[model samples]
Target: MTTAPSHPTDPTMNAIGQAVAEAREGDVAAARRKLLSLWSGIGVTGDPLHRCTLAHHLADLYEDPAQALAWDIRALDAAGAVTDQRVQQHHAALHIAGFFPSLHLNLADDFRRLGSFEAAAEHLNAAEESAPALPRDGYGALLRTAIRQVAEAVAQRDTAKRDTAPGRTA
Candidate 1:
């Protein structure tokens, strides 16, 4: 059996830790902004794993799910470029972010707005089917509750929108 090599502790990871701390304290926007700058300074360079991880982090910030998906694709490609077996494991473990159900739901909302009910339903079904793993703790419960509430709200809004549209059939 082959084991993945551990990532070396590095400046970039250190910066990411600091940024995450800030984000946990409700400073995500600011943390992400600083991260963007710091990341840019790293510049035109990094190992494949590093580049893939950075791309994934940036993609998480998008309010527009469609754009997020685009970034995810880039990240996936970068991850795949790594030749090391250990690196490949690292990359494979993270593939779900590109197809996360929550993100799909957001994209579904956008599709709904564009009057694409079929597409929206497809996204909604996908989101419902994808069982994204959650943390197992009080914090996880809180987050799950919040996410469910948001999903309910989105469902309600979609129903309302459909009802209000002319010639829409129940």
Candidate 2:
């Protein structure tokens, strides 16, 4: 089931929304700064759902990826703590942790570029797990595609090496 928005009438949430609107209207720095202020006030201890909402907002609005990722991890931990549904938390964390198929695929590409085929395979496998939750035609598909592509590459490399050996047949 879909979760409810954190307090429909909270002034803080309203302010955040306004700032986001302003950011969308071309005052990105101002909007982000406003979010940062509100973000600091959001204490770590509170209703898990409320924290999740705030965390999601922070993750979406923050300009710095490191900061956003920190908030995402916090949200995931809080969600896991409050609910019996561990799978949902895992899914949310994956999204927040740059595990979306596209991100994972890009990461795999970087590993491939560095000649770390094993690491690339590991990342591709992770990307595959998150693929079911990602958009079928967009980032998610890219992740699944990347996994397959990398797996094929690994297989080809292995085959090439084997074929070149004196004892191996073509």
Tens digits of per-residue lDDT, candidate 2, 47-82, equal 554455456445544444345445555655555445
Q: Best by TM-score, which number?
A: 1
Worst 10 residues of 2 by lDDT: 161-170
| Superposed Cα deviation of residue 154, candidate 2 (Å) | 14
5 in model 2: Cα distance from truth in Å?
Answer: 6.9
Worst 10-residue lDDT window for candidate 1 reads 161-170
